[model samples]
Target chain A: MAAKQNQENLPVVLVYRRPQFNLPHRNRLSRHFILLDPADSQEPTSSFLSTYAQSVRALLCVGYSTITSETLSLLPSLELIVACSAGVDHIDLQECHRRGIAITNASVAFAEDVADLAVGLLIDVLRKISGADRFVRGGLWPVMGDYPLGSKLGGKRVGIVGFGSIGSEVAKRLVAFGCSIAYNSRRRKPSVPFPYHANVRGLAADSDILILCCALTEETHHMINEGVMTSLGKEGVIINVGRGSLIDEKELVQFLVQGKIGGAGLDVFENEPDVPKELFSLDNVVLSPHRAVFTPESLEALIDLTSANLKAFFSNKPLKSLVEIEL
Target chain B: MAAKQNQENLPVVLVYRRPQFNLPHRNRLSRHFILLDPADSQEPTSSFLSTYAQSVRALLCVGYSTITSETLSLLPSLELIVACSAGVDHIDLQECHRRGIAITNASVAFAEDVADLAVGLLIDVLRKISGADRFVRGGLWPVMGDYPLGSKLGGKRVGIVGFGSIGSEVAKRLVAFGCSIAYNSRRRKPSVPFPYHANVRGLAADSDILILCCALTEETHHMINEGVMTSLGKEGVIINVGRGSLIDEKELVQFLVQGKIGGAGLDVFENEPDVPKELFSLDNVVLSPHRAVFTPESLEALIDLTSANLKAFFSNKPLKSLVEIEL
Candidate 1:
């Protein structure tokens, strides 16, 4: 570990408020490396970054932390900056590139985990397994109610928006369920197995299942608007495992209320941890607190992969998944 | 269709309540088969027995409705009786055999469906998908406490009892999730992919996930008693899709409360439709109202297969699954 760290001094840095990762490990990082934590100062131990900035390079950070052009001017050794999480809106990527410092991100790492969760959420919601548990637990068994029987995954049409790594992985699992796949990307990839549509409304019109797998890019923000919901057939089910900002929560609630779509499985919301209160009375939606990447297997894979990337970076090797920042 | 039924005059009358013969075209069979709408009648339709009884070589049935000796005596032409469901306790197999009758059952038909539900139930239970949905529907989100994070199915050790068709199917799916499989049957089948044990205690001792997939017979009743529970390790999970009689519900509840076993996913209950209210408060367990084989795909398969059997029977061919009642 020591030999790898000393091989080359990693100058640029970015960090996020993630559940894992600890301080003793952070302290062991090279003092010459720029450090940034996206989480607001919720933990007293996170304040160690201010004192360590003297020998730092450049910062692409989040939350209460800031990286001004003045701070950029102070660090003569500063070269590049990157955000650790998917959203770069939190980081001043433009300013970093304006100062000739490259910017990057850790977006693709979560693709598979999020995609897996999307499929799982879709299955759970459609099957009504959770409601059955609630019914049994409530001691309301044999009460003779209209329990919903579920449909098979086989022979269903699934539409995915944003044909990125996560979208592709989700496509793979759905294939195993016997579903016919389709997707819509900013620009169509001719190599994809499923039919790629030109627009979100086209995908919605064709799909029985609509999946939001796109990132929270500006043009993509709130892309799941009222029009798209109307296009998705009345029996269609939507699953969102992407950025909360990508969906129009109000529109979703309205659609759910009117039964515009059969059901929805959401891991993210417009304002998460503060989901729209109006969404609570609808029996057609399944909700998760934006947690698709937290599975133990995925977590272990994520840490090991990220650790490998860091180790490689410190060893003067080309970094993996280098996010391109426009200068 | 009428002419075909007359030509195929089934020698042994196998009565499966809600046989789903019309699932493919539910609306189509409104006039053909002697449909026994359990909702409309507490007793088997008189026309059902009378139409097929005169030439009825045997009586094949299930436990949904009472089948008394008098009912059996009514069919003087009865020579054999087979049950389509797994359990024979509901049928007076003794009286049938005493009357020199034979029997058979589609014992393994529901295995695949049950196994599918078992996995679904476990995932839903552990992930608290239903609870999240309820929270979202009840307008409690966006002002919420904690969003439930689900566990992954991969890397768990699955223990199966009665290593039969359903148990084997469960093992197959669990293996896909990267789980190590172990099972106990009356005797192990060497060709199976999983490791087999001689007793339930051995299976429980090593498994992280213990499942009940055995038939409900005298020898297997209450097999998952206190000793079996103790052997299943403290962190183990149990899923029962076999029979209610196999588990002691009171003991299971106690063990769950005491944290002896991690959780349970139950489809059948000792006294179903009357599940304990205490079960609902705990977040660990998932419950289904014995509706595992109620999926559209399975329902279609059941109807198609049963219709095929009926067709074959009237054609003077032997039945597909013949159980030896006289043996």
Candidate 2:
């Protein structure tokens, strides 16, 4: 077929394992790029990458697939790392910086959905949506008469932990809900109107709610701890849509159990796929597995942006979503 | 005995039966007016109302107590019915109109919280916040790997069914989250920016989401029927923050079961304290126990508003929250 011939002529792209979803647009990616999978080759993964992907100029990293320095070395001809995920912590940024390999993340494509989730979580925690859902599902409504009242989101002093693309989007949404917004970031965002706190503890001290949307880095690891939780006080809520390590997970669970803080709506956990079982029964907390970026609209947008970035790379045009590696 | 003596000097006010929860504000209401309750007297309920509430000029209606013609007949001197609730469905609007009695609902005090819940429910259903929270809590994440992707709220064509105070508030909040808004009101709102559809069926046909915030009048009852749900199609979500009867509950359950519609986030059911057991197991539908107006903030605001309205009534000035019972 002419299409098969065209596929053979297209540039080889080493696509990491497919995302575990029914991605309708992912199938269309082949029309633009000849996607090759190491898992599909008869040979083992490392050898397959060395043989077939050695001359591959671009690699499309899907989900949280690790791209190590050793793996980068294998793809000596690789010019670009197109991440199909918002967070690039799994990819070795330092190695890419050393090699001068270009990195394009899915931030622009996924920012709205992630921000949507962050606001959703904040509302859920404050309104007890998940808890109320559980109570209704348990057939307790008829007997219980009325579900417990939840706190209002309006006029709450909200502190955004990262005022990045995702955090900023969250502030935009919550502002319409009448929440007063503030933030704590690596640097004060001059373009933003919110008061910037340099420290998470200070942010918590001033905020009735804290929404975490920063990147996971060594310096920012375990940024939300017992002291910060205590500072947030008995009525403060924390909504984390960023990586799990952004908070002290054990301490958060302990604080939630001990009632040091109001509640939480957690999309990610420190030991993911292994959430603390203690949270299972808590009416105040809403626990969701790390799924902030998991939306059909976001995923489709990711496919489009990633394909454009690859097309731009092959054509030597300005790349889309290129992240300046702060090495 | 000074407090008891002060109560004798205060103006008489007939307080309706208490809500299920402890009313911390009810104790303080005595500081403004001499509170009268049928339950407080040793006489029977009807006898107490006839004896103690006969001369009461202002009555504080709490919870869903029915102000029947008979009950109103007992308080012939009653001039104002200050409801501590937004919906006056339980109150005899026709009877009050015929008797030329004034009524004031908690629309102003509870609009923000109800709107907050509507937006929260929309986000929860579209993003599967409640379902994902359930998946994580059930310890199924490790086994399930990832929850199914939910639709994005951004850019979705949201058709608001009723465009009153709560609907306007919901639209204001959702616009910031990137939802394209439309509405179906009894009459076109000249002040609104969104497109206006004359009928709900047409609105549903054009919308990815439908948010019901209209009052439950005789004509407005069961507004969301099978035709509307079918027009919304397989990807459309319905969010009800208004009274339960606004939707045909039986048809909604059938549609969800057949996958004819996308999902629903129900804050109020057709029957109070009773939801369809069929909806209990559906993953797409998010069930809430009629608590959209039950936030602590709204409750406090209601207390303040009710107190103010009662104060205004006794002083013979214009009342706050005066419902102009459209006769």
Candidate 3:
């Protein structure tokens, strides 16, 4: 009876998420707050939000569900959005800014796992780990003599796109493998030691490997296009752990099929779960099903971070992982 | 011609290797010395060595050809043996010691590439890079939903077997990934910061990952056996970039099949080019056909080091990568 009374007295938090994004692990969120989830109710999301979330000051957005201006208008009392992902591109930054709403993302929680996968993908491409495994599994080793030699990872110049938390971690790990690092971002970070390129093409031209670790936004969509691939040259490799739309998929396919680009390790495709069928036959490419940031450790960290952010907002304390909304 | 005369005047260095091991890159060694290859002659190896290599003071042993006492007896004038591979197990070290012959190996050249592959294989197993690639290639992503989440690389307890050049290099790379390292070797390296286990089983008991980087010797053969595997627990991963015989392959396969051991990343096997068929279907294991140390860059470095060692031996200078013979 005491526990039920305490739960009823807890601060209310509106949970906004798509049906597919509903995870069982998220039930932990209800321990500290009264979560008002429309999915749990019979009414439509808009009607449910209009009924119970009218007085809700905080909203937790799950996965990549887009929060448009129309959705924002429904939650008139929402002062903060706690994003359960590293990227906030799906959220209406302009509308949120107009409504004087604050935003926080899971970059701090996802950075290490994302960076680890980026390095793993880069190594897999350069060393042909996946290709060699296929050769051995196909029982070709006894007949084919030795598998072809892979390129050395040491002494390669790696150019990272985005000098964000994940990009910085990738640089740190690759440096230990004897790779020199450079990066391209919206702006040059003062404290980072790696040389910065103002554009992706310049970074590609100077790098033996180009890794994408940035957010997907209007200016950054399709940033890795034909010109960038050409600049990366025939010997360069690309590793993408960011959003699929960051690269122009059609041009990338042509470049890969034509052998214009050396290889690719793609975790994100322009249209995921629908990767280019052409890439299926290529041994030089390693295709992952957009799982770089989905490690159990990182997911557990994300849950803790999301709960902390909500608690901070309700307790009149400073929020964590706040994104600087560009005007 | 002046060049022809200079080549004729160069000191003799006998090249002993199987026909398959005759690499084109080794022709570079001919510039500095007269390479008297027994395989180049129609005469039997013993007859050829006795005839043309009577005055040869240095012998270059290529690949993993067994240099027995009988072969050593044929080369009466051989004062030094230059091994073109990392492990000198195939060379008659006891016979070489008895004859007061010095030894050199390509460990210095192969260490970085071997270390790179070891880390690549570890990442492949943990992140399921190869498994995920297969899933994406088989067009299963769209139908199967999300691929299963992989364990994080960071915070893993890694135990390195052998603290030699390759082992040290592996440690350097894994440290950047936030893995805690411990090591077991013939002798504890005083300068290494990682805790040393006096035995393999103890190391396995504490580590989430055990990497084999030691040489194959009488005492070290089948070092990773049933006892060590059990101590490693069901969640422990094994990575062998050292040699195949270092592990009991039959036991390893059984453990993997029964889920008594977690996973494995094998570059070397108990038998070359012929891996156990049972491992082919296992997703947790990453297989490479004994090509971990065969990167183009590493091969180039080996050629340079081999030539340098031969030149140093002829000129009475200290040889590079000299193997310390245990008396």
Candidate 4:
């Protein structure tokens, strides 16, 4: 829905964090005297509502920090709730509907950076690059080392679990590696140029490498389980740039120990920051802490798009990624 | 010169080190009561013999070993000298030429393995996979550490020096990365599809990365000097898979230290087993002990092909890669 147009000195409170306004186009959100650090009391810092709830006609916050119905009730004047992050999982949609507030997000800027990470992890696994480096630096070369043997990625089968924007971008990068691409999603994306598999297990079975790039929803939660791991061939590798909840952590650990699958490269885990010790034991795995979309370019794009998204909301234009208001 | 068609049994001395032969065709030399380790303490090894003065009609030897003409003068029966390596640089070629002896070398089998190493080094440098692993494993991650950043080679400009068989194979593998290829050689080889540069420095300046794939010779000695390194841009990366003598070690070190050139990947060093200590200080350089052609596949091929070359020599057929004799 288009934002309501009431442009006569409408007081709007900028939410949690603001982008650095040092560039050429910095005054996009200047008219809305932003509450830079909104909630400094209950959360101690980095929350928006605790400080400016009374005067907040509009609440601009990120998706991670909580935005409760109680917090919205305090902002009785809040008309727009714009989330800076892509996902709206943390927002209370039911409350937003009751309060008659509009919600929008920044998402498109994330896909490119996330997809680059996915492809980089894939190459890291196939080439045994991480393992070799450890071998070399540990003074293992010509000492405690075996041959640095590995197969090239010029002719391998790659299976992508999601056919969304990010997954398709991953496929495009893998295409340059001369690998065949196969993907599985909820339904076949008709416009997709590559082959689609109806089942993730089958995709894993046919593929030399399996990449997880799907969204984290109830249907995909713990989808890569024991069966999926077993179905993957002996030399199969797994790369997950998607949510950690998509994988069954216990089953992954067991598979890694038995070498049921060749290796894995993970940017996320079942829990944020609470990784198992066994995962680090195996030299075959490469791990990152859910920061795939953390490039400088991606961050700037996200802030610009999110600011534009908020500006569009206040100006009564159709929002880019609108969701139900959690009033 | 052809092998004698009807020769009586004679004492044949194998005076040097070579890979063990398991070929049935080597029996051609066996008819003359061939010796595996000749007890000629006073005689020269295979490399230092005259064409007609040595008692041994044929010699089999590895690279980096010596053969002398003084020993050849004591025998008065030498006819041929064969190398079990691709390079026959240590052999006394002109002395043998003066006496009409034939020399053959094994070259083709070693090309593929070296080419594989060149490509492996290329990927290792561009991806920065090694450095990433080091950062993660050093307890630098979970709380605080720098990210492992790298650039993709999807559209980089690659310049190859000494575009021979190995160089061309590297080009084939790099094509999958969507890289544009430029090359420098003694003369333009029309068979290759890539563009040729008349000047080496011009090629270095134009390329995003430079690769050395040429043989070691006087005309090409120290070709990659301070001037060539300066020609490369600050972000340019260089990979050397050819002979170490082709590059100036001190210049490369200085360029890398000053960041005049971005990085270097060296499979061969100017001196074997002794890498410069300064190179170890820089994270940008990757050093390997001249074993680009040390894979199992290439090792087997080298041995099998050398045996074949030896067999062909005793069977009165033209030998492949006859260095000291006319082809």
Candidate 5:
């Protein structure tokens, strides 16, 4: 009866998730907010949202569910969006900006995991860890003499695309391995010690390895294209832990096939789960199923962060990891 | 004529390498020393050594060529043995100790590369980087909904078996990843900040991961046996960048096959060019053909260090990485 009374006084927050996606930490979240999930209703999603979530002040966006302007129209009272993903490409940022709806993301939760994967991929590519494992599994080591020597990570110049939390974490880890860090971001960060380039092409030209960890914004889409690859040169390696659309996939395939680029460790693709068949045969490439930020620890952290953001917003306290509105 | 005079004036150094093994940085070393290689002679190794290398004061032991008492007997005037490998197990240290011959190894040259590999293997195992790549390459990602999430490296308790150069380097890199480090060396290092364990079992019991980076000696061989693995428990991971003999291979295979231990990332196996066939099919273990210290950069460093050590010995200067013989 006490719990029910407490729940009755809690703020109403609509849970915006796909039908297949389950809201993590549902039990923990239910204590502070009355979560209005359309998936749990007998009525259609549109009817369910129009009936109960019309007056919802906060919406928690789960996974990559598209948050269109039309969806925003349904929740007229929605003042805040707490995203469970680090990247906000699916969320209609412009629409939210127009309505003055504050946004917070799971960047702090996902940054370290993404950064860990990025460094892992870089080391895997440079040292041929995956390739060597494949060779050993294939029983080719005795038949074939020595596995070809891999490049050392120490003293390599690494250029990071997107000097955000994830990119900064990667730079921090790689610095310990003696890599020189440089970055290209939307704007130069004045206090950062790493040298910054205004453009991806300029960064690629100066780097032995290029790690992509940026957002999939319209201006940044296909940012690592043919020209960037050409500048990166044949000996350069690419590690993409960011959104798939960050690189022109077709151009990357061509470059990799032609040996125009040395190697790649890709977690994301332009079309995920449908990787280029050509890449499957390349020993120089490591393909992951877009799981850079999906560790159990990070997922748990995401849940806590999502709930915390929503709680902070309700209490009129400062939000953690808020997305800066350009407008 | 001047070049010829310079070559003749250079100190004679006997190069003892396997017949199939070509010395790296040969050109660089040749400029500084009169390299007497038996592999270049039509005469047998013993005969060649007796004829030309009898008075050779310095011997460069390359590529794990055994420097036994018989081999050392060939060079009675041998003052110093400069090893091209980090581990001196291949060299007869006892014989060198009895003869009062100083020894230097490429530990300083190989430390960074070996450490890089140790960390690489740890990340590969923990994050399933190689396994995920295999899944994507085998076209299993789309068929399988999602690859299983790997454990996060952050907050993992990593216990290093050695506190030498390579082990220390591994600790340094892992610290940046937020892994708390402890170590078990032959003796506790007074200078190192990480907590020390007197035995492998103690370290294993406290650690989530055990990394083997110590030299393979009679006392240290098979140190990470059943007891250590048992202490490590079912979820523990072992990353070996040290010699294969540091682990009991049969026990490891059994533990892995039975799920008694979590996973492993093995670079050196008990037998080179021949890994256990059972391990070939296991997804939990990553196998590399003992090439951890063979990076092109490290190999280059090895050659430079070998030349430096030999030059230092002949010039009466202190050696860069002299092995302190246990008297």
Candidate 6:
């Protein structure tokens, strides 16, 4: 009954300040509901949120932006936290659950493009596509003789770290290329035909390539550490299209430097927009600017999904792409 | 009868002088026949062959090295020419046919890797994998904002320019990626499941991507010219894994500059080792030195196939990968 009264008074959406690279979400969002962005005010974010504490029913979180318990406590009337990215690690999930506030994310939104990127990075690292391009672009092809031979994609034992929507899409594409598929997920999917290893180490030990496509949580943070990379071995490669924190970046860099791991195709980094300078010079490592989610077609899809999720939440309809907070 | 006598005595295999980058074929070839390499001799190539012309019945023509009528005339005793590469454009086929010299090539050996490269390039160009990799490595992500979005590959209309072994392999791999396959072959392949376009322009008109995998012949020379590129429209991508002569390079460059065509993934350039300076700066294009056939595993496969073909010819058995000269 109190919730009904809150809806009667025009529902308010509190939005975080836009990241440097974010696409404009306000103009489209303003067409539906009243948006209360903190950046619009000259006052500090905490101060602005505190002023509208009783009215803000939902918060729209941007990529990699934090929502700590202290911040959550400031918005006592908050009900839903809408994340604009697939990885919700930046959000305090425990606090959301404890407060009984529901959380939603861009899961179905970025799945296809991220999967496409995961496959692209894997193929690039395996075939030396980017390295060869640099060779030709540098005028080295004409003067420096032939580029070295690259490994084949067919017959490779590819182990996916997360067997979710994106990982499955990646497996589907690689399967067409004749790669043997295996995986390590939080829980074994009985219907999935690919071999499942219970742990990342076991998956790495059995895999020729380890692809990270899982979400980041307490159990999965730094899951691909030295021991996992060691199990992956000298001939094995790592492809990360998932969140950067999923792998221990320091260990991966050290292993890449020592040639303990064969190669890597990384889209995300531990401190994104700030990759290690050491990786810049490596021929085998293919670096992407955290853009697995930035394809134009993907961006269009995201805008539609974002709008739908927002509208559904405001009208109190069933939410779109509502992520299970625990899983 | 004479062939039997020549086989009884160790058969003479004449090898052409290799360019700087070719692998050493002597140690491996020595097991089956007496190798008569021109580079081993201090005398002129003509003079060296003249001394053992009668004994040198088999000629192993190294990659794209011309076997002109003049060279063939000098080796009057030569009856078989084993080409070490797939395309026999450099070899004067009319003269070889007039002389009744049988030929075998590395088509079967390099088909899979070449097909693998074609798919890799297609994915690279469409997804901007290499371009995005360059953006990250340049440290542009921290300040330069989001990289541009790329197109998806799953639903693109891919037209193969040939339907031979390599072409068919490319089709199989692409079909797995959910691409709609079509073809433009000299004759309709009744057995092929893909739709057939009678000419290059028609194929381009219907295709979102064009994959050049045909042999470069008199009929196919400069096949993908201005007309074809124009027909392909501004959104089409071209992947050339075949010889560079298949496309008119100037027209391609002009089209790319004007955005008449979307992008290209070129492994073979018209004047290799001399790619257009303009191409070096284009983010959309993915350039590779003519290396689709040179993977270490493919090289090992080629060595085996070469050995088998040589042994088969000497033993008077049917040849493997023997080209249908007229077809």
TM-score of chain B of each: 0.79, 0.93, 0.96, 0.81, 0.97, 0.94
DockQ of each: 0.44, 0.82, 0.87, 0.16, 0.86, 0.61
Q: Taking the tens digit of each residue's C-alpha lDDT, what string does model 2 give over B215-280?
A: 778878898998899899998899998889999999999999999998999998887788889998
Q: How far in Å is the alpha carbon of B110 misplaced in model 2?
A: 0.6
Instruction: Point to the candidate with the largest TM-score.
Output: 5
Q: Count the backbone clashes (under 3 Å) in each candidate.
A: 27, 0, 1, 14, 0, 1
Q: Please provide, for model 5 over A1-327, each residue's C-alpha lDDT reduced to its tens digit, 9 standing for 90 to 100.
A: 997888889999999998867787799888788988888878998888788887899999998899999899888999999999988989999999999899898888999999999999988998899999999999899999799889999999999999989999999999999999999998999979999999999999999999999888888899999999999999999999998899999999999999999999999988778899999999999999998987888778898899889989999999988997663
2 or 6: which has the higher lDDT? 2
Q: On lDDT, who's better, 4 or 6?
A: 6
Clashes of 4: 14
- TM-scores, all candidates, are 0.81, 0.94, 0.97, 0.68, 0.98, 0.89
Candidate 1: tens digits of C-alpha lDDT, residues A176-266: 5557999998888978978989999988998889888876766788998888888997888989987777778888887888887788888
Docking class of 2: high
| Model 3 CA lDDT for position B17 | 92
Give the top-scoring candidate (DockQ).
3
In terms of docking quality, model 1 is: acceptable
Kindly list the per-residue Cα lDDT of model 6 for residues B1-327, writing each as its tens digit: 996666557777888745553544567877678777777778888887777676577888777788889889898878888898988888999998998999888988888888888988988898898998899889888878778878877778999998898899999888766689999988998999889999989999999999999999899999999999999999999999999999999999988878889999999988988899888889889998887875666667888888888899989899887987873
Worst 10 residues of 2 chain A by lDDT: A17-26
Indicate the TM-score of model 5. 0.98
What is the overall TM-score of model 1 with all chains considered together? Answer: 0.81
Better of 3 and 4 by TM-score: 3
Q: Is candidate 1 or candidate 4 better by TM-score?
A: 1
**Alpha carbon lDDT of each predicted model:** 0.67, 0.86, 0.91, 0.68, 0.91, 0.85
**Range of the 10 consecutive residues with the lowest summed lDDT in candidate 2 chain B:** B17-26
Error of 3 at B1 (Å): 5.7
Interface RMSD of 3: 0.9
